[model samples]
Target chain A: MTVQDIGFGTASAQPLPAQKGPVTAARQRRTWTIYAAMCVAGLLPTLLGASASLQAAGIGLWLPGAGFLSVGGWAAVLFPLTLALFVFSLVAWFWAGMVLGPVIVWLGSAALAGAMAGDTVWAGGPYAAAFATAGIGYAFHRRNVRLRDAALAKIAPRVAFLDASLAEVRAQAAEIPDPATREMTPTDLAALRYLLDRALQPVTEWGGFDIIDQFQPAALRYQLNHMGFALGIAQTAYVPNFHGYMGQAQRNLIDKYLLRKVWGYWVYESCWGHLNFTNWDPAARDNIMLTGWFGMHVGQYMLASGDRRYLEPGSLTFRLNAKTAYVHDFNTIIGSVKTNYDSAEFGLFACEPNWIYPICNHYGLASLAVQDAVTGSDNVRRYAPGWFKMLNQEFTDEAGSIIGLRSQHTGMPIPFPTGEVAYAAFQNCFAPGSAQQQWAIARREIAPAIHPDANGKMRISLPGKGLDTGNYKSGHTGSFASILVAAKEFGDAYVAEAAQNSLDSDCGLEIRDGVRRYTGGSNDTNTYAILGQLMQAGDFRRSFTQGPHAPSRTGPVLEAASYPAVLVAQAISDGDNLRLVLYPGAGEGTQTLGLERLQPGRAYTVTGATTDAVTASPDGRAGLDVMLCGRTAVTVTPA
Target chain B: MACCAFAVYLLSQLLWPLRWLRDRLLVAPAVTASASVAWSPASVAAPVARKWRWKPALLLLLAAEVFGLGVAATAASVSAPAQPSVEFLDALHGSICSAVKGSLS
Candidate 1:
């Protein structure tokens, strides 16, 4: 099927309308206001005919170097350079979130300007201002940390109260059968529709994704990888044998990822961030963020659909230009992970240059696990033991929470929101026991936040202003999505339902044109939410490790169908028989579907279709007409 | 004034190659459905990867530096009677304005 014909309708084929989202817009406005104020402050010195030293000092405040206009001659060159530096610093600040670098550069340039003008006062004035700004920034950071610590201290007692009740909740969750076996509900189909709407569009089109800062989670790469993940999980759990447009949708995401626009940022990041100008290949060094996440994404596709195309040499080549590209395949990509893990002093490598994030390392570990399952290798066994040891010894805090981030250079922890709750689901793929314990602790800690809403349904209420790291915005949608993922992974239905309720009620849940999304959340959070919605008990672990069931591998499969007309909720097989539950995605209508892998020259008894029996063609393909209204079930078995 | 000019000139010289590299690397071929393949090593036309040539840029930078130093020396000789700080600041101001004007043009 063509890209437009795969999803619900032409609207679904188009990219989702670009939205800055309220939180991101507010943050952008605040940043612009700050810059504007700085400009006004700089203009004051120039307007007042201040001393050369004061005007030079104003250079640090004003990005446009308005103060430098008075300091004529070759010094005029500084104006252009100053403007360039300001723009560069702003970009660096946004990309890396490091305020100190910009602070140093701005003040340093001011001081240099003063020194060059033979003004001793100008040289010292900017330095003093820089010191004051730094001290104030640090104070605010520490105060926020203290307030957070105090808040968590208050919740410490309630954690014990909830810990006692978790055992029975978990025991009850154990009895729930695999949710994938049942037919997908309308809500589930809608959630899957959100993914399909984005994935089915042209690779160049970025609809329905947050395009804020490119350095972190908001980058297109992270969004693409996560979408692949959700789709791979849906494939493994729901429609393993079906590889018509579904498989193509997954491949399209991978294709988009290979585009230079999606990943070209790494080259600049490598040059400046890592200070490595020679080799800009993203997969070569310490970017576990790219290699690890991408590895798991590609490996999951292989495992779920049994596609070995990526395993071919140079299959995943990252073309830098007409002349230069980083040629890699599944094995080479995994080889990079192994090399990084082998050489890493912290036993976990970094995402950016010097920042080590345990959550990202968990992705790396899961990648290893998936690679092992896909290739029948022993990478998880070879690496996980030491990886866990380094994680515990170096990365664990006193409260037994995984430290969100640490400086590989300084060996100091930076407070990020990644705790047990965020790590549990990914960690489950490689280390289920540790993952279970993490979920147990996370459930207890988050228990204080779980309370009844006005409708008496349980929901999560995170303390303080919620932060979505994806967009660097303020929201609780990401927190709820993470909790939902963990809760579903370990069969904690009580919390899963509660977290889902929070996402639905609190995070602006919207369904339009048969697609579901949380308008309040970022693309990353929405993807995570979809992943949580599709998952059931053991689904996360099974998708990454064990993959689809053996019987589902070789069976009569639904090969082609009209999209938005025939929605395949469940297209699974039992070695010989193909079972499909179709829903009318656009509206109720009759649709033709093609089936493959059927036993040739055999008459098949088809139920819930227009024809009662149809013989397979000589090529093992057959056409059947089915009328879809509500949930219509069709079974094709040899007669 | 001369020192400020020299510093700005040197900084630009140092940053030019990086900017050149960035622009070159960011240039990517547009992908379409017909051009897209599952996996093919043959798709990437292997050309001899060229190393960045710093000699030409460096030569231009060196020539500019010599020209700037000669002009500074000549200006110093002509304005030798003025107070050193006043002369320096005035020259600095003049050079900065000219540099700014040159950039805008």
Candidate 2:
């Protein structure tokens, strides 16, 4: 929905008095006049200048720099128009408290600015300010918009616990009067069941889709738009009977009939959340937050797409992918060498959730794998050759499993990494000085949670809250020094397992007396984990958390049918199992467990720094099992 | 100045006739003409008018370009170790403009 759509939600029948006030009439004229003037003056000039320089220099459309396309032609065309749109978006800031609208306008401005300069050699550095501006502005605006968008704000809260019980859930569905629906296949049905597994996971329960986060809510803000778009798109892709709704017939139906009176309430915020922690006015952006969120949001949807829609063919996306260059978790080292963005070079550090921080390499590449799955996009493909090359360089070891860096938060990088036997490792948590951290650190090495313990569960917690205001983190790009393996463990089960093991932070969220508490240690990471536990935990875990406009939720496991409802539609098209296995004190053959499940006959696994392969093996493992010096994966044959 | 350098290169990419678009039976006559018009060299050239202004414009552009060049150089130099071919090609790209300009003018 457009920015103006928010004002129409209340269904207030307030007719405008025809020219009752001259002042009002004059104000309208000025708004349009100035907007027009800017188009002719400010916008026209910027476009011409860019077009001229690019053409004259022979930079062409395929600029060698990063952000080349996103910032180029579109910038020249839409930026000026958007500046006008930004002013209009602020109406929400006035009415929606401070959460939502202004951020959209702020983001519009920054995105436009990025478009303007992304093609240049020194683009992202200077352009970083625009990103920062968008992040902070959007965050502030998010609060404002949330306030004004009452219908969206007032969605009836759902009972999440109702989702947990498998039998109860099925019985509830059976109780539904409608008997006309056809039963789906076991595969499709099973997929639906998977989504229900952790229906109560934080990201999902909150409606953010990312499912876990304190700052985000499922309401009409983030979910209504971005996540909503994803869900809606996914629904269309999966439903055989669903005719095209994007074009005329469907749009006409919605516009003429359905939406004529549909309340703007229960809408999504914006798909793109803003996080920037940079020098461009802290009030404007938080470069760390944005870079982190950007990596997460992009990875979540981009990696999920089963189609090429995620890619901009013949575009910058196809040239310099964010997946490979930015390096979300263990990205500092790779990005340090490959691109200009890094905590080492630029002071960009912020709090990102999950394990694999400081430098969680497996999660880093697994995250990139997510982007590739979305479209197998040309851009995704371009970076894959290089990304896998670099990822194995530092992250992988002699065996097939991963080897991750343990952030020296409490102290220094020990030569013998904590829990060296494993392929991937993450600090118990980044807060070495925390009251609880001493206990975690003193435990000696971090161990991969291979088997469910007495509790039959795993847990991880959010690291120390707030931005880094000190020397160590900002200097070393180590603020992520904690763990934010946001997109680790892409397709390989082994990799996924290893990556998941790193996120052994606090996971319990038991709410009491309307107060939600973050109980220590629930090592659940990834959509699969949250979805999985909620499915299995059932009523036992109820009263844990609530959903948007709902009572404290219990037993609300998402059905596998809901996979399309989460993440981007494109991601579902190209399916690749992703993982990152961290071997627990590996000696000879400890590293290759997770990757064995990969369909060897159909899949070709490569390993080592140059994506090398295993020529032969002493153990007489299948030739594919003999993963080269380092990493490997088996997959369903690539389409 | 850059416009002069890129004109030939850009034209080269578009050297082939855009016949499929115009000759296609399915395309409505109305849009086809405009589509071609949108890509015409004259239309593309018109944007240059607003850019070619006074000394300040040049200076601002020069500064931005220099900064861009510096960034390009650093990245280019860093990658030079693994791919000498790239380094050599970059050197070649740098000289192409000057070399071409000398002959064309």
TM-scores, each model vs. reference: 0.71, 0.22
lDDT (Cα, 0-100) at A324 in candidate 1: 96
Fnat of every candidate, listed in order: 0.03, 0.00
DockQ of each: 0.04, 0.01
- Tens-place lDDT per residue, model 2, A1-639, is 121221211111122122112322343456557545532443332345564323212221111121222344322333334434444443332222223444444432342233233234333322432454356558867864553353232222111111232233233222221111222232222322222222223221221122122222211122222222222222223221121221112122112211101111212111122222221211112222223222323333222221122233211111112332211231322232223122221111211211122232322333333333332433234443443333233222222112232111111111223221111121111111121121121111222323443564532222353221111111111111122211121111222233244333323233322212122221111222322211211110110111011110111111121121221111111223211211111122422221222223343344321333432223222222322222222221222
Q: Choose the strongest candidate by lDDT.
A: 1
The DockQ for candidate 1, computed on C-alphas, is 0.04
For candidate 1, write residues A1-639 as lDDT tens digits: 221221110111122232222322444466668767875675466468676656665655754442343344445456556656666765564456343555655665554454444332233434444454466559968975784465446334434443454464457446645533756678988888778766877777665555554687768788889889899988888888678778888999998988888778788778766777778887888888888999999999999998899999989999999999999998888889899999987788988776788888989989999999999999988998888766655665433456687766545456676777878788879876566656666777787788999899998888886876656557888888889988888788889999999999987777767778776776777888899998888788888898888888888888888665677788888889988898998899899999998998889999999999999998899999999989999999999
**Each prediction's number of clashing residue pairs:** 13, 125
